[model samples]
Target: MTRPPEPPPKRHGVLRLWHALRYSWDGLRAGWREPALRQELVLGAVLLPAAWWVGRDAVHVALLALSVVAVWVVELLNTAVESVVDRIGPEWHPLAKRAKDMGSAAVLLTLLASGGLWAWSLWAWWRG
Candidate 1:
């Protein structure tokens, strides 16, 4: 006899929230596990608020906030890329190193862009 198909998973609201929290907690844990990430988080937290204060209007403040968030987003993506690359090969590999380096470069680009945005906005506000 043929076996029956499996039942669909439950979609309770509380359970969904719990799952979301679990994922967020996992990401937070991973971020804190790295010293670089911890430093980045501290820097972003300190800089974004100052940027907001120096921003003349809501638009500038919003742009500054988004730029800072962009940095963190890229870092998260870089971490994920590194994790996957490591999983694919436990041993040392040149290609894996290249992949990680590219991810780090992306994060660097994001941070540089954020710094540019913050500096330009603050400078304009200061001069005005």
Candidate 2:
């Protein structure tokens, strides 16, 4: 037998926007509660204003800010992956370990990129 059609998605407008914002805030709060996420957030808080000061122009500022944000984004994704893996079970499975390790590697790479970008901007500012 054929399955019934799925219901249409809810309409998009002001109410939807509000819900999206609320959900985003909830996620931020959840991230903040996590120790590693909290530390990264504090680091971002410090680096953001410093970026404004160190950047020579809007482009430079954007680059620096985006890099920092990218790291945070990757970290959040990594956290999500780890959470899911842990939820599945506490067993020492190879696939689970691999997934967590890959997520961690992603976060590490993002951090390295952010650091490199900031360094490049600082070097340019110092030279000019």
Candidate 3:
């Protein structure tokens, strides 16, 4: 006879929040294994505090911080996509290539946007 299926996982209230946090932490740990993500995190470490100096006000400071964060967000997404594609099997597939390429493109776009924001913020701060 077949065994009974496991009960559905909890998905509400404080338990859910705790589980979500744990999952997010796990994701970060996985991301740390990626060299590109590690590099970005290192840069973010330096830039986050530097934002205090680069920002002209609270809003600019928050914007600066978020700009750095946006890069990490994209990098994590790219990592996830690459992982999934690689998991699908070692054999090359056109669609897999496309998906990976698109994910990379997304990361590049986020990097560019974050860079632009930082540059603009620095320029505005310096001129003042």
Give the per-residue lDDT of model 1 (tens digit) for 3-23: 999965766899888887888
- TM-score of each prediction: 0.82, 0.84, 0.88
Per-residue lDDT of candidate 2, residues 1-128 (tens digit):
99999965685899889888888898888788888888888999999999999998899899999998998898888988998999999989999999999999998999899999988888988988
Q: What's the lDDT for all of these models?
A: 0.86, 0.90, 0.94
| Candidate 3 local distance difference test against the native | 0.94
Pick out the ten consecutive residues of candidate 3 with the lowest summed lDDT.
7-16
Candidate 2 segments exceeding 4 Å error: 1-12
What lDDT does model 1 reach? 0.86
Error at 87, model 2, angstroms: 1.0
Off by over 4 Å in 3: 1-8
